[model samples]
Target: MSLGDDTGQTRIRLPEGSDGDPYGGARRGGRSSSRSLVTVVGVVVLLIAAIAFANRGGDDSAAEEGAASADSPKAAATAPSGKKPVTTKAAGIPAGFTHDREGAQSAAANYAVVLGSAEMFTKARRDAILRSIIVPDRVADFEAELDKAYTPEFNKNVGLNEDGTTPKDFTFVSRTSPIGTKVTESSADTATVEVWCSGLLGLAGESSTNPVTSSWFTITIQLEWTSGDWKIVTHSQKDGPSPVPGDERASSADEMAKAVQEYGGFTYAR
Candidate 1:
């Protein structure tokens, strides 16, 4: 976890976007087979991978983009870069943001992914993420606040061990998907961008008390142009661009588990 780690400008054409119960039956159906259920499970897993988890979910209030700021920045066409960018990670989170507005939005989206990650519940990885992505002076404060929020009780509610480990035979999945990013305000030294996100959180093992479920949220990041890069100064989330629950039959626990294993997680850069 020593210092060092690090994305390219990915154009999403402005579009987007796991969690589970093991043996228990609820809205997630019976142990019995249903094609619709399996399809739903499969689709959610793949969507997380494809829809851009970097802009993953947040609190319900995040769905509200607030009144448009009078000073908001214009939406500039994302400059086409001939340079293929290489990704770097510091302490596992993407590092070294660029000096432009696209770079700032990219950093915000990637930061949202890491922030909504399961690692954020653990002290070491959380520290690493904060240290790598946050403005230097704010790291300690953010760490302290997160430590409080990710308390042991919270871990239990989310089906993690006291230390945030997934129980044996279970894979814990918590991911944020960024639908898109818009720059509301920007300057040479400061910027604010809204990342529309969707997230999944829960345990993906048999008989898990807390099953994975999806949430819709938004993350607004205030970034500073520091050390030749955009670093997060502060960020907050609110809930939902949530859609009405579909009438489609829900997936069974087994189907959800199988899908989690068959698919792999993604490394979001834009």
Candidate 2:
């Protein structure tokens, strides 16, 4: 008698000597058919039990993982820790940051703001800013590099005078606002931090050739802990993680100039 059907349904064929009637088979043949049926049913039941057991095991593991996560401490990277920000100023910029990863990030952010400001285009203010934030041995190097970068031709290109002054009827708009900061590397005495920033530049006036425009960028500042404060060891900048520009209408030059005057920048160490 065949033990299986090709069409997927389980089938049992009675012995060749048995009659077609269900109860007319010989006693021996009936016993043999009953045993075969019982064996097949037992195998199917075992397979079903195994499948159910495996599913339950997976669920238990998932529940255990969820419980462990619930009992663990919350992530600290994105949350504030209630530490006070730096409260001192040098050369009109924030200074005296704590000697920690957070402090490095704060210093990097504030340095980015000042470095991208209109003041940095002028020699005196630029030197003052560099001296305030840069490490002692590196201050002169930074000044020299910036002096070459902010030459008369560069100043005129950004709609400023040859001497880095705003024209009489036009207001030069150069500002940098740091969006966030991250510490990429840190040690007991030195750290490297990246500051993501938004900036405004150009001249704001009705007849100005270069109207104020916004751009996004990131600044990397390597800092050293010195005299209980963070100072810049090296600094560099790169263009953004910028987002798509919005569809909002551009403000008039008068509105832009007035808003800049009314809204003074903040100390970003916090």
Candidate 3:
């Protein structure tokens, strides 16, 4: 390096090299790399957006399916308000319930539960209860039969009082809960229904002869919709495919009584 005295400018000299491409198009390579990175980021964004859209669509489909199931043929047909009064005469009696097939079925089903209830084994309350549900014409016959069936001997067999009462210091728990309902047949004026039910009938008390027990049964009822509601013309029952026993400790009479008093029964509809 040397300095020029005219303006004190410094200069340097080097060996000569081959001439190559000018304008330094190497900037294009950097730009290309940046473009590739942007493309990758854009693809990732698109993928995330697509996934979100798919999940939202799936949720909507599930909601629609749930709504459809609640309104399906089985539910609709079994519901109580399907038709007008369907009346049928039974056993020389002008006994006909409403043709509200579903309503009739439901009433018959629930009435079966009420009739077979432990309450029906009693005298004073039983007749009143039956009169409320049974065909007005057949109420007397049903009451008479039930009274005869719940005899003193039968009470002893079930460890109850001869007067159709729970023994002193004992708690009786008898209940029926419907598992499901089905209509086997339906016409303009008649329908047959089957109701599957689980029930409990037993004594719960310390030193109680009849400790709490449960039973499973299904009841089938032939119903005719008459007047304004469902009434049973016939009812039948059979044993069940019962569950294995559980090892829960039984409650005392006082506890059972208190629980029953606190709990309420449902006014079941089809």
Among the numbered candidates, top lDDT falls to 2
Each model's total of backbone clashes: 29, 0, 8
Full candidate order by TM-score, most accurate first: 2, 1, 3
At residue 214, what lDDT does model 2 achieve? 96
Q: Would you estimate the TM-scores of all the predictions?
A: 0.67, 0.71, 0.60
The all-Cα superposition gives candidate 1 an RMSD in Å to the true structure of 15.2
* Residue 104 accuracy (lDDT) in model 2: 82
Better structure of 1 and 3 per TM-score: 1
lDDT of 3 by residue, 17-78 (tens): 34443433334568766765676566668768998887785778778777885437664554
Residue-level lDDT of model 1, residues 69-182, one tens digit each, is 644434533333343343777776666767787778778878898888877877887898888888899999998898899988989888999888778988788888887777
lDDT of 2 by residue, 1-270 (tens): 334467876655544554676644556658776787897787678768998887785778778668876425334342444667678898888988877877788788788888888889888899999999999999999888888999999999999889999999888999999887777788999999888899999899999999999999999899999888899999888999899999999999999999988999877653
lDDT of 1: 0.75
TM-score of 3: 0.60
CA displacement after TM-score superposition, residue 116 of candidate 2 (Å): 0.8
